[model samples]
Target: MRDAYHEELDALTDRLVEMTRLVRSAISRATTALLDSDLQLAESVISHDEEVDRIFAEIEASIFDLMARQQPVAVDLRTIVVALRMGTDLERMGDLAEHVAKVARLRHPDSAIPPEIRSTILEMGQIAERLITKTGSCIASRDVESALELEADDDAMDRLHRRLFKILMADDWKYGVEPAIDVTLIGRYYERYADHAVRVAQDVVYLVTGSRTQDADLR
Candidate 1:
């Protein structure tokens, strides 16, 4: 029975890793669609969100089963609980990617952002993707050190987010209100994406080190 329980737990971990990979891919593709102004790719990302949702549901069910059947205690309980939290974070990350895709579709034929701002958004997207990938690695390896490093990376993303805002606000009188609103919303989405990834990393830290790190301030 113990052997079977362990096997099931391992399978759950694999599924969580797979879900993370799917979300990371969605984020990357959504950004690529935005950069290349590929409406088709954006549509694809939007459609793929359903799959992410389905995976989240499945992971939740698995976690419930593990809890009911195995009655995991101590570290095992932490691992299962962390997996549940990480799945929730990954699902939210997928939704954010879908939101970006929707923005891409709305700005079709004409990019939503000015050329000058596009590079910065792209950089933010890259950092968000890195954080997602790093969170997945931390979960798979159960490496608290890697999880801490992922939190540090969020600092760089936060700085970039702030810097983008400075540029957006500096010449805001020249650009109309709609463009400014769009830029602000886009920055919020990326920032929130990073925040979610950081939360997942923190959960991993708790799972491995058995200590909760400081909670990330999402705002």
Candidate 2:
């Protein structure tokens, strides 16, 4: 029975890893669709979000079942609890990606980001991809060091977000209110995506060391 319970725990971890991997793909594709004005790809991302939602439901159910049956203790208990939160984070990341794709689909053949600051948006997307993929590694390995690193990784996304605001606030800006709103929303989506990734990594730190993420780095 002990071995079986451990296996169930391992299965839970595997599910989270898989979910994170899918989130990484979703954000990457969504970024590409936004930049390229690829309506077909954007539509694909929006529709496929259902899969992420389904997986989220499955993970939640698994956690409840594990808690009721196994009564997991110590680190095991932490793992289960953290997995539930991380699953939500990953699911939210997926939704952010879908939101990006929705903007792309709404704009259709015209790129959502204008030419002046497209590179900045591209960089933000790149940072997002890196943050989420590293988050998956941190979760799978319980690598506290790597998890801590996400904080600084998130700083890059934050910087890009500030840059977007600077551009929008500049006196020379000609894109008008509508495009400014688009840039603002897109930048926010990317920033929030990175924030969620960092949160998942932080949860991984908590799972591994039984310390809050903020305290985990002190060791």
Candidate 3:
């Protein structure tokens, strides 16, 4: 019975890691769709987002069932609870990716970002991808070092966000109001995506260190 229970826990971990990979793909594809205005790819990202949501629901239900049946304690309880939080964050990240894809779809044939700030937005997308990759690594290996490094990784995204705003607020800005709003919303989507990845990595840190007090920015 104990062996079976442990196996179930391992399966739960696998599900969480899989969700990370799916969301990572979503954001990466969404970024490409945004840059190129690829309607097909944008639709694909939007459609497959349901996979992440389904997994999140599964992880939540499994955690609930495990708690009710096994009464997990100490590290076991911590891992289960953290899995729940991580799944939630990952699902939210997926939704952000979907939102980006929707923006691309809405503006079909025209890129969401203007030429001036395209590079910055591209960099933001790249940083978001890197952070989420490390998030998956932390989940798979329980690498507390990589998990801790995510805070600094997130700072890079923050910097890119500021650069985006500077471009928008420039004295000679000529992109017009609709483009400005699109870029603003795009920048925010990428920033929030990175924030969710950081939250997942922070949860990994909490899982390893057994301290939730360190993460004050989980939102």
Q: Please identify which of the two predictions, 1 or 2, would achieve the higher TM-score against the true structure.
A: 2
Instruction: Give the number of colliding residue pairs in candidate 3.
Output: 0
Between the candidate structures 1 and 3, which one is better when assessed by TM-score?
Answer: 3
Models, CA RMSD each: 2.3, 2.1, 1.8
Off by over 4 Å in 1: 213-219
lDDT of 2 by residue, 144-219 (tens): 8888888777888899899999999999999899889888999999999998998888788777777684843422
Clashing pairs in 2: none
**Candidate structures ordered by TM-score, highest first:** 3, 2, 1
Per-residue lDDT tens digits of candidate 3, residues 109-201? 978778898798789889989999999999999898888788887888999999888989999899789999999998999999999999888
After superposition, candidate 2 runs with Cα above 4 Å error: 213-219
Model 1 shows how many backbone clashes? Answer: 0
Candidates sorted on lDDT, descending: 3, 2, 1
State each candidate's clash count: 0, 0, 0
